[model samples]
Each structure stands twice: as structure tokens, then as C-alpha cells.
Target: MSDQSLLRERWLPGVRELSFGGDYNPEQWPREVWAQDLDLMRRAGVNLVSIGIFSWGLLEPRPGEFDFGWLDEVIEGLHAAGIRVDLGTPTTVPPQWFWQQNPHVRPVMRDGTVLAPGSRGICCPSSPEYAEASLRITTQLAERYGKHPAVALWHVHNEYGAPVSECYCEVSAAAFRAWLQARYGTLDALNTAWGTTFWGQTYGDWSQVGAPAQSASMSNPAHRLDFARFSSDELLGCFTRERDVLHEMSPGVPVTTNFMATNCPSMDLWKWSREVDVVANDHYLTAADPRSQVGLALDADLTRSLADGRPWMLMEHSSSAVNWQPRNLAKRPGELARNSLSHLARGADAILFFQWRASRRGAEKFHSAMLPHAGENSRVFREVTELGATLWSLTDVLSSRVQAPVAILWDWESLWAQDLDWRPSVDLEPRRQVREYYERLWHDKVTVDFAHPTADLSRYAVVLAPASYLLTGEAAANLTAYVEAGGHLVVGPFSGVVDQDDAVHPGGWNGVLRDLLQVSVEEVLPLPENAGVTLTGGTRAGVWAEDLAPQDAETVLEYTDGPAAGRPAVTRRALGGGTATYVSTVLDHHALTAVLDPVLERAGVTIDRDLPWDLEIVSRHGADGSEYVFAINHAGAPVDLPVEGVDLLTGEPCTGSTKIPAGAVRVFRR
Candidate 1:
């Protein structure tokens, strides 16, 4: 079968319309309340519910004993009510009894402090004891409900590595050593790769290496990077172990685990995406930053890219305000619909929240849900049902994919290595730099897809790799070939300087991409706080500057001030049928546009120039050969779009210059 057909068949087989629901923890309530939940779900158009996510303690109250009686009732009740289930593995939180029986399963932090079990996700991933218990519970879950007509997907452990990711226990240290040995093969190779000679810290034996924890001074960068990699891999190992149990016991049941936002350092979702049948994510708004909702849209876009154009799930989000933030502000009217539709516009086939009902007693008691503390008569419930009806009305858009001619590269390892200790500047964050460009694209109404550096670039006309500090040889080769094949490539500063092992390349800066970008770096000048450089076109470069000279490329932007005055700040080169542009300075929004606008135009990318500042537009092609345009007004003021289309929400024909109220989402069918 073709890859597309195979993906649909394997990940989300026979899913019609967008599945709408939230986590249903029936265990939290009495058996009498379950019937009410099902009735409420029906009213809300919720056909799918995630169950038993954190019910390990209830499933196995004591070791060597199992109880499936209560769970059976829950599943049977949901099925009787016509709701399919995404059965959770319940491995994220072990029973308190299991941890008390085996104290060694607890994780130790970097400061050698053992994390006492007062919260969820506290077990050490590297501990075999924890793995064994996880396998046992997962096996029993699969055996009991794998073939049940109610189950649709196997939901693996909840949010892997959320609270405690890296464990500095002895077991984890030994595991790290074993991982390094397998990666480097020999001690000499590991020493060279880590540059161990610099600090008189050479290791002659594998046992000498331990988790990079609690160093007297700044830790070794390579050691920290490797430890980060190992920690992510260890968590992934935990996921795959549970997944294998489900796959063996329930052959056709697709499996997935919820991934957090992209900026998380613990688990690499890109690598983890390959292991799961479907990609699912949980995102909550940054309450501290008022303007962070746009960042939330970016997170959804990145998650869609991780799914590779296939429909994924928005596994968890808040119906209103989240309790965990410092000051949880409830979402305003229409914010719920706007947020849910935004995910659907970005390739999510399902919109699910963290909870079906609000908790009466727990750490998350105040967290909003489909049914809030105020009950069915509340505003939250009204909006929940409204959003569900809208989803049910758009069944024709099911399985539709978001297409983008522009691709932006995001790398986990580069993010890990770039902001490590002793860097040129503390502000060399990979995400912040990429967002500068991503935000501009959003402002200009340009659609973009997030990609790995090694992803196939043939389908895209423009590719942007910003803050790619560490480049593997394979990734470098892939991008080089992409430019050679008539694709326009834009690279941010500090890219291609180091290899995968955090070792600086021998050739002058931009390492493998030196010739392709046709520029060589002589020196780097990190601007002090509150200092910046003046550039042409009224553009200002803040935080970073590189003394660059063009070899075979032409200088596009020149640094007119700062220590690297009169040097090339931006350079471009044309090679075999394509072009490559490099930006050497951290440009403000205006400066970024001055450099990127021309590149987008040259690549034939379409940007709605007349789009309002507060409005964002996304287009998706429906499975039934129709087109969907989501015009979302994110600002507090209304926006008037001078376009004509049918309003899918109201079924009214909209003509030129339609006004969308503040924080409203208008779905247009063209």
C-alpha cells in the first residue's frame, strides 16, 4: 500500500469526523455517576473517551494481585453508551504500595536527592524493577480489554518524563555507561568524541562515566549533552516496552502517548514519533506571558509536522483556565472554540481535554474541564457542547491535511547543545531564534511546516534552518542536496559550527555548509546587555554578531556598527539551480523581515499582504475535495477580511470585507 494509505490504516483506521472528548476518569467518581458522564458525553457529541490513564493503584492494589472488576464495568458502560475508548496503560504513576515495596524504584535528582513519591511520574525509567511492574500492568490491561469492541487506541504511559526526567541513581549511571559504550564502541573513541583531554577528565574504563550530575563546577558540555540524550532514550525505552506489550497482546490496536510542548528538554518527540502509531500532545497556555497564545498555535503546528501530515490527536488541553500556572486566568468567551478549532485547522483529527469533569479533590481540583465545578449550567459546559457540535458538523473535513510549501527545521540535539554552559551568549536559545522567524511568517500569512533537518525537502520550495548550531554529517548532506535541487534555503546564525558529538568542525564556520553558504567566519562578537549593532535598511541586530566574509556569495546585509563594523551580516549564494541565504546576526522583527521577505518572494511563496495584524489564516484541503479556510482573529479588536467565502460555521454566504469579532474564529469554505 502507499505510505499515505498505510498511515491512515495503521494509526487511525475508520475514524469518521473529528473525535471530540476528554479524559474520563470514572474511577474518581462513584459507579452511579458514570451513567451521567455518558449522558453528558452524548449531549456534547463526544464519541471517544480516554480512560484509565492513572489508575495503576486501583488496577493492582497490591503486588502479585490484580483487579479488573471495576474497570470492566467502566468500559462496558462506555461501550453501552456508544462511546469508543482509548485505553490507557496506567504506567505513568505506579501504585503507592509498589514503591513502598521497592524503594529502589524511586528516582534521584542531580543533587543526589531522592524524589519522594508525593506526585505523579516519579519512578526512575532506568530501573528494571519499575519497567517490570509497568510491563505487568500493561500486559494485564491489553489481555483484558485489547479485543473488546469498545477499545479504539492503546494509550501508553501518560506524559513520559514530566516531573522527573533524569535520574542520577546507580542504575541510571550504569545504563548511561552502557549506552555510551554502544554508541562509541571503545573508550578511546568516547574520549575523543567528548574532548576529555581538556579538563584532565579522561576515562580509561566505562565505569568511570556517570550521569552528569552535581558537578563542583560547570559540567562538561559533551557529558551533559550525552546525558540529556540518554535520559530521553531511557524514557523512550519505557514507552516502547509498554507499547510492545500492547502490540503483542492486541495486534491491531494502534498505540500512542501524549507529548508535551516542543520546548521541553526531557523527551525528544521527533524520535518518539517514529515509535508510535499516532502522535498525540497535551498543551496548556503560558499564563505568565499574555502574548503566548500565538506560541501555542506554533506548538500545534509543530505537532502536526511530527505526524507527517497524518491526522493526530490533541490529547489534552484545558477547557478554560489551568490551575498549575502562577495566576490561572480563565479563558474569555469564544477562547475555547478558537483554541479547539485552531488545532483542527493544523491537522488534528481529534480535540480532547485533560478531563471530562472537574476534580472534587486533588492537586488539579481547580483545573477546568468539560463539566466544571458549576455543573452543566455553566458557561464552560455551554462552550464545550457548542465546540462539539461544530466538530460533528465538519465530518467532511475529517482526514484532511494541512499543506505548506515552506518548511522550518527544528532539532532537539541542537537545542540541547546550543544553550549549554560557556557559550558565546546566554541568549543563544534555539527556540527563541526560530520563533523570531516563525512569528514573522505567521504575521505575513505564510503557511509553514516544521521539519527535521533530515526530512525530505523535495516537496517544499523554501526551507528555513534557524539556530542550527550542531549539524550531523547526514543532516548537513541532506540540506546541501536540497539547495542543489532548486530549493531555496535560509539558515540562521551559529549554524553548522559543531558536529553531532559537540565537537567543533575543523573547517571555518558553517562546517559542512561552508561551501554551500559561501561564507567563512573569522570571529564572533557577542553584544553585551542593552547593546546592539546598526545595519542597513534601518534594521538593528541585537545579542549576536559574527565577523563574516563572503567567498563565492554576495553580501546582502552589512553590519555598519559594533566591533564587526562593515562586515557581512547576511550573505547569499546561488549554486546548481538553487540559492542559500545565511543570516549572521540576531535580527529584531523588522530586521528579520528585511532579510526574509526577499527570500520568500524569490521562492514564490504566497503571503496575504493585506492580512490584518490581529488576524491569522490557515487553509486545509478536505478529503471530499473541498477547501477550508480558518480566519482566526487573535486580537482584542475585530478584524475585517476583504475576501469572499461561505462561512462554514453559520452556513451564510460571506462576501468581500467580512468583520470577525475579537477572539472569534470564522471557518470559511471556498
Candidate 2:
């Protein structure tokens, strides 16, 4: 076989169907139940399962002592039952023995409280002892099961920055200093970048630097931002360490670590995605939000974009209510299928959950799983099996890519910078801004992909920057070139306010984008709570407003009330071949939709105007020139979708109109 084919074979073995399964923890149950579990998995059309994620303590009960007999039996049973394995290194949870040996490796909080090892993901990323222990376990696992017939993929670790991301321990401090030296090369450059001269906190020696630990007052924003970067890199370094070992021992098998893409703000996925062979993500619905379905779509689209349009994996999601939320809400009837299909609609080749069977005890015992506590006869398990069968039938959609004409700028550094203290308003939430704009477009029936600010925008007809607090000079030049090349750009308020180092642009607000936008912000006006300002277009905005000065741009909507009355609340600048529109205040959803309608029309971006508000439509194109349209109805009543194809879910012919039941999903091959 060719090298590529050999690698594919090693990753997938003989599997030619879409992967369907969840994390299987047979160690939690007795040996008698293992056979029954395999039988049920076969009945559910499960072909792949992640094994040994939290098995560090179980795999090695004592230091250097191994217990692999049970694991070997489980793997043998899975292969005999025609199941593949996504073997995990189990490094996320270190054994108690190892923790006892290296107690100092425990992560320290900013207030100097050393975190105990009762929970998962409690180790410091920069600790050399933890690194050594993790690699030791990883090497043992890879050497044992690297060429195992059932092992298809290597799962390096669990969520990297969940319970703990940054550590204020002394080890982390020294590592942070080293990272700064490599990045800045000298203390002079570091001082200039951090702007430490203002508070008389400039460092003369590298030893004086710390991990932005607890201070008497607020720490420097630049220091905190770089520390966030360093922490993320530290976690990534831990992952690559194990991944390299796996690659060496299991030459052709693919390695990946699940990402909490939208959920975890610590890791920068735009950078992390480049390191993984297959990008996988774990997403859970926020029960508090009534429109969490919109958030789900947003997360799925972002995950797909992180994979660069390649088919990614839904590594973990709840079949019902999750245990961590303040008030866990159970999934309604058909909601499970709807959620899974929504992810599949957005280019997810594999549909998996956190676990196969619900745990009987532990902190996450209450967390929902494929097989709930109520067992296989329950609604959750029935829905899971039904979805599995549906996925099995829709194998043609595997490897298809979701195509989008619009792109949204997603920058983690900008988010981290904006999250710092003492911004214009604490209500200026970056994620909320992006989601509201995404929700508007979702309602407009527009499929969107996320792009880095500095990425090529020529492929997208319309590029939107809903929240870009930190816009670098290179990114600014890229945006200018994209606009000059005839691409429409829409920027939200409070953007271009800072550069990469969390420092304001040289001249004033809206730094590098001022020329391209043809406007400048004289000052930022943060309104009080519950207070709103009016615009000429009958739109009300609150929380944030800018004193905008239009140089050559035409005033689309001028403020009619409040501090900046009569100033341009919204402006449009005609550039070389296209136009750049800027919204100087946070507009309500209705107003945002109204504003984007004309922009969409001018850009020639088509929208499903006749589609129902609760119905979502997205298309994925196969390599063989086939198109699959997924229509998901989140409402409580049936809706008629106009499409010409055969429904893969029911295998029925729909000439033009298909009647989709309430809270149902339909995939049509067009």
C-alpha cells in the first residue's frame, strides 16, 4: 500500500462506514457486563468507542506496576465484536500514587492555595515532574497497544484547560520567564510591550517576572494576556509530547485531543487545530439559555471551521441534561436526534457522547449518557439507537464539506485581551457579540464559517467582524486588501481598539482600520445599566456607543439621542471596489437584521427568505459532486421545507416540499 493508504488503514482499519459510538468505560462495570455491553453496542450500530480516558489510576495502581489484563480482555472483546478503539493515554487524571510522589507538582491558585488532586485536570502544565510522569505512562500504553488490531486512533488527553488552565505555582513562574525570554529575547522589549512603565513595575531582570499571580490591585493587562498565551502553549506542549510518542510507537495511527472549542476560552483553537490529525470537540448545551440550539449551531459551525472545512468529530455531548449546569434541563422528545443531526449537518463525520453508559457513581454520575440510568428501554437509549441507524444509512454524507459564502472573524487573543479588567464596559462581551450576529445570520438562513482576522478573505463574499478588540497591523492590511478586492466587510463597535500586545493603537481608537473604515472614534461612551440611546433609524442601542467621526464615509444612521447625539451611529464607506460598513453601537437583534439585509443583497449572498424561523438549512458537498441538505426544525410544530431530493432519514422522495415534524431533522441527498 502507498504511505497515505497505509496511514489511512492504520487509522480506520477496515471501517468503511461513519463512526458511531461514545466513550466506553468497561472498567467501571464487572466482567459479566462486558459481553452484554458489546451486544448492545452492535445492536446500536456502534463501530468506534474511546477507551481508557480516566484509567490512569486503574491502569497502574502503583508506581511502575502495571495491570493490563483487564484492558487486554476488553480490547480483545471489542475487536471480536467488530468495534474500533480510540485509545486514550489517560494522562488527564494522574494516579494518586504519582500525585503523592510529586505533591509539589500540584497547581497553585493565584491566591497561593495549592489545588488538591480530588478532581481531574488538576496538574500544573509547566511542572516538569508532571510532564515526566505523563510521558512515562504514555510510552507504556503506546508500546503495549500501538499495533493492536482494534486500536485505530490515539486520544492524547481529555479537555486540556477545563477545571484548571493557568497555574500560579513557582514552577510555572520559571517556565513563564523562559517563554518570555524566547518571545521577547530581552527585558527591554518585554517592558516596552507590557507597558510596565506606567505603574513603575518594569522588570530589570528575567528572574523578577512571574506568572501574573495575585497582586494588591489589578495586574497589567499585557502581562495577563501573554500569560494566557503561555499557559495555552504549555498545555499544547504537554499534548504534543504524548502525541509524538504515539506517532513513533504507532507509526500510522492518527492522534487527537478533544477541544472544548467554544466552551473553553483558555486554548486558542485556531492554533491548536494545526497540531491535531483530526479536530474533535466537546459541546454541551447551556440549559439556562432558551435558545441554546442556536449556540449549538454556532459551536458546530465553529468546530467545522476549525477543521478548515474538513469533516471533524463530535467527540462528546450529552444525550440529555448535563450535571454541571445550575439547573439541568432534560432533552425533550426527539431533541437528541435533532442535536446529533445538527452537528452532522455541519460536517461532523463521527457522532459520539461523553460516555456510552451513565456512571453509577462519581462527580459526573448524574451526567446524561447514551445509555441512561433507566437503561436501554428508556427514551434516551431508544433515541440513540434510532440516530445510530439513521447515521448508518447516511454514510454517503461522510467526508463531505460544508460550504459557506460568509465568514466571521474569530480571534482568541482578541477575546483574551478584551476579557482583561478596566475595559470601556464590563458588558462589552466578545463572545456575546459574535453570537448575536451569528444568531441574526442563522435566522436569516445563512451558513457561516469562521476565519482568523489575518486569513485570506477573498473566498468569502461577506466578512463580518462582530468583535475584534485586538486587530494587528498585518490583519488590518489583510482586511484592507480584501475590501479593495471587492469583498464586503462589516465591523462592530469597540473594534481595532488595541494591537497584539494589548496596547492601544498608536494614533487613537480604531487604530489600523481607521483609514480603511473611513472613520475614527474620538471617544468611547459606555452607558449605564438599562439605559439606551436612539438612532435615526428607530433603533435602540445600549451598553456601548462610540463618538464616531465620518471622514469620507456616508452616515447611514446618526445618533438621535444620548451623549453623542447627531453623530454617526452607523456609517458606510465606499472603498476601491467594495464597501465597509461600521456599527458604532450595540444594536438590538431586529435592528441588526435590518442593517445586514441590504449588505447581504449588495454582496449577492443568497438567503432562504421563505424558510421558517425555527428551521435551519445547510448543505454539504461530497467529493463526488453530490449535495446533501440538512433541514432541522427546532419548533414545536411541523414545517414544510422546499427541496428537491430523497430524504435519507426516511428514504422518501420529496419533489419540492417536505413535511418535517416538530423538533425533527431530515437529511436530503440532492
Candidate 3:
């Protein structure tokens, strides 16, 4: 077997976990709707349900009143019906009374203007009134539901980044000043850190340092970046508050909150992952086009990597095309199967559909649900049942499973820092780079874990941090230690450029890796969008390219024929027992693969030679010396698989060749 295949066989008995749940609101329907939905779930093979997601209006109908009668009914009802319940905190959209009485409960924008309140998550984190009320409610929740046998896991707030940025009110101003005082000690220190000396924008006192929530100077990436940081920390602080309450109330119940897949720039997932007991993410991909599909799937993989490859629940999905899109398209008969399989193929633990029954009214009313208004005898229901039965046959054969070796460090902190940095390319978008890096590795069948910069790195032989945009003091030390201990490292352009406070270092901000990279630059070129820089003429390509002054390094790819031509777009240097590579431009898929081939070779990782274009292959090495191989054919025509293996989904044996049916996923074991 090929080296890649060898590694593949070890990632087996893959238990794919799914959330077979959707906004379950029996309160909106009759009791009979519950039975029909439950039966549909049984057919859909859904093992879990995330009920009471938006039940605030029903749970508490009055001021200073507590009522969970409906939620309690659903939990007991589902448990007796044989479904696991993921309990949502309902901490997101608080009851109207709570906010009305304490007007300071809501967040105010930077100009001291209050946010228009109509939607959920309008509360300000810095508001003492909001914080106190939110904590009180969360603690009350943990106190009430801690020992319920029906409760499986604690679901914190839903999509915690609602209302986007927060708190520019007087309370927020006071809090920001306090936080700054704690961070920079005084206004002089803050001025020095932000280099206020440059634009003469230095603060005279801590009170003058306010949040950038809709600041007067709009489009301030620096202030926006800092606001983004404060927002992330603030949101995380909210999460931590609830989790701590849960810790005190029910230590055994693992805590988690479903994350919106596309909501990255606002929420720091690295910080969220650390607080979540089991990282949960909602994947909503309704696009029919190929690029969008690829992008969405790459996002799924990146989300999986975010929490270090621990199996995460597929929190929310539409059974059919969601109405939220401009052009709503329903899932074809087997399309749900394709969607569920795609999630499993990437790294999803559970398969679930959002909104168990269709809403009778509201914006989501038109959205597809399991039991549509037509009831259980629908085409969607039949397909749901068929998939559910098939999943039941597997019974978590891939359960109690974990991802193997490869680690990818994804840091939102670095992204924020880079965005806030006063210099260099304004185009170094962290989210774009993250998706690009994850997709490249995933296409090659590399089992990767999304790790924090401060996470332990010794387990994986190779670590890829595409945009290590924000490198903290201790985190930089951790990276240095990882390299010194002989693990290969990869960093691209715009990396090691800033610290957590959105400030550059005196000695070239590559921090710990600067000495190891051996290359330093006082100024780097920033290419514009649509500006294509060709490297090596024959083999390499990248956008927004940069040049480097190589020191103790070999130039791998040079921009052979552009205005900024002959400048190095790629460079490599030997460091300790491993190697460090820097790519100056973001390569298109083919170009990216071409560049990564050499780097992967250096790291002793290889992909199959004759893999088909529309076919995706993945390899995972289990911790207990087991290997599993998954080959998925995403094309119309059947292809003859080239490797030898046994059929894993079933105990059936397979030979040297196998035909992977179109849109089919085949798992094999050696």
C-alpha cells in the first residue's frame, strides 16, 4: 500500500455522530404533532434533539417569574421517546422584562448610541446590569436542570455573536477604561503600545480610551480589530460565566454551545473551544454550485479542526433548501443522504436536521422542516426515515472515536491582531487563508486537528499554521518549544507580525520563530486584489504576493515575471530537527497543491498518485494503532478504486479493486 493509504487504514470504525434535531416547538403545535415528528426522527435515524432553542417567550411569560413547564415536558417526552436532549441555556434572548427594567442591560455602540433592540442577543457584556441579570438567569437554569436524567449536555447561548459588536455606552466606556488600565497599566503605557505617538492620537487618560463600537472614525481597522478582540473576549466571558455556573451545579454534564459556521470574524473560536465541554457547530450549506459546495465543505473541516478533532455534533441543518436563500431549493430525494455523508466524510459526529416541524408563522415558517404542514406522509419524510434506518444499522460503529496525528493551529487572536496592525497588507484576511489551508490538507486525506497556538504540539509530527496572525507572548514560546522539540512548522506571509494587543514587536514580530526562520524584513510589499504574481514561471502561482530578503535560507519560488518580479514568493529554512516554510502569496488550488507537495514531502507525508479529480480520499491513524481509509467518489461515473482493503461499514471483505458508486462513501480497513 502507498504511504498515504497505510496511514488511512488506521482511522477506522469511524462513528459519525449527528444531531437529528430542529427547533422542536410542541408549544406551537398540538400533542399529536410530537408523535409524528418522533416517528419521522426514528426513520431519520436521529439519536439526539436540541429542543427549547428559542423558548424564552414560552418558558417565562412574566416578570420575576420562572417557568420551564414546556421545556420540562419536551425533555421528559423525548427521553421517554428514546432521544437524547441537548439542553439550550436560553441565555441568548432574555425575557423582555429583564431588559426593560434594567435598561442598561443592552449594549450601546461606541458613539454612546444605544442599539435598536428587536432581535435576540442585544445585551451588552460590559453593562453591569446586563452581566448581573444574565448570570442570575444562567445560574438559575443550572440550579433547576442540573440533575435531570433527560439532559445529555448543556447548550449555552445560541450563536453567541448576535448583535455583532457590543457596548459603547457610558457603562461600556467605564468598563473599557478599567480593562485597559488592567492591561496597559496606565494611559502612557497604552499610548506606547498602540504607537499613539505616530498620529498624535495617544490617550491622555484611561477614561478617554473607549470601545470602537461604531466609532466616529468609521472604517478604523485598528480600532475595529481591537473592538473585535474585546467583543470576542466579552462573548467568551459570557460563555465562561455560564459554564462556570454549570461546573458548580452539575460537574458531570458536559457544557457546549452551537457555533454558526460562517460566523468567524466576530467570535474567537479558539477561546470558545477551550470553554466548551464538547464543541458544537451549526453547518448551513444550501448552495448548489461546485465552488460554494467546496467552500462550505472546507468550512466544515476547518470547524472540525477548530476543537482539535474531537467529534462535534452537526448541530443544525435544513432538511431541504432553506427559504432564507434568495432562491430556495429543496433537497432531492437522496440529497439529504449526500449532505449527511458529506459531513461524515469530512469529520462530523452526528447527522441532524433543523426545525423538526415546520413553523406555522414567522420568518422561518417557509423554511423546510421534517414534518411539513403536509404531515409525515411526505417525500422528505420517506427519505428521512430511510437514512435514519441506515444509520441505525451502524449504531455508532464509529462511536467513541477520535482524530489522529496532524494538527493545524487556527487562531482568531492572530487574525484580529493582523487586522489591527497599522502597517502591511490590508488584504490579509484571516478567514480566507484559514479556509484555503484547511481545504488543501483535507483534499490530500490528511487527518488534521484544529489546535490553539497555546495547545500542546508534541503529539503531531507536523503542524500547519497558515495564518498565525496573532502570536501572544506565551503562545510564541509554545511555538518555539514545539519547533525546538523537533516538530515541523509552516507559517505563511502576514504571520508572526503582531501581538495580542494589536501591536508589532521591536525585533520583527515573528517572535519565537524569527530566529528559527532566519529571515528578517523591515518592509514587505503588499499586492492588490486581481494582482496575479507568477512565481517560477512554470510551476508556482499566488495572489497578493510579497518579497523577502532571504537570510540563511534557500529561495524556493521566485516571482519570475511580474512588476515586483524576481522577488521571492516562497522560502524555506532548516530549523532545529525540522523545517519552516513561508509562502508569500496565496495560491489557487492547483498552485497551492504544487507548493504544498514539496513541504509535505519534507514532512514525510504523501498523497495517492492516480487519485481521480472528483474523488476525495481521507486517511486517519487511530491512537490505538488502528488505521481506516475513506474514499468518496463525488462524481457521476463509477471509478475503480486502486487500493486493497476490507469494507469497514460492513464486515464484508473487499479485494484489490472496488467500484465506488457515484456520490458514495466507502470505508476500508487493512
TM-score of each: 0.97, 0.98, 0.88
Off by over 4 Å in 1: 1-11, 642-645, 655-657
lDDT string for model 3 (265-341, tens) is 67878667666766677776646555444565665666776655656667777778787667887766666766766
Compared with the true structure, all predictions reach lDDT values of 0.87, 0.90, 0.68
The all-Cα superposition gives candidate 1 an RMSD in Å to the true structure of 1.8
Q: Considering every candidate listed, which one attains the maximal TM-score? A: 2
What is the RMSD of candidate 2? 1.7
Q: What is the lDDT of candidate 3?
A: 0.68
RMSD, every candidate, angstroms: 1.8, 1.7, 5.5
lDDT per residue, candidate 1, 510-611, as tens digits?
Answer: 777887898988777888987899997768988889988789999998989898888889999998878999999899988988888888888899877676
Q: By the lDDT metric, which is better: model 2 or model 3?
A: 2
What is candidate 2's CA lDDT for residue 241? 92
- Number of backbone clashes in candidate 1: 0
> What would the TM-score be for candidate 1 when compared with the true structure?
0.97
The top-ranked prediction according to lDDT is: 2
Per-residue alpha-carbon lDDT of model 2 for 365-438, expressed as tens digits? 99999989999999889999998899999998887889999999999999999998888798878899999899
Question: Judged by lDDT relative to the true structure, which candidate is superior, 1 or 2?
Answer: 2
Error of 3 at 647 (Å): 3.5
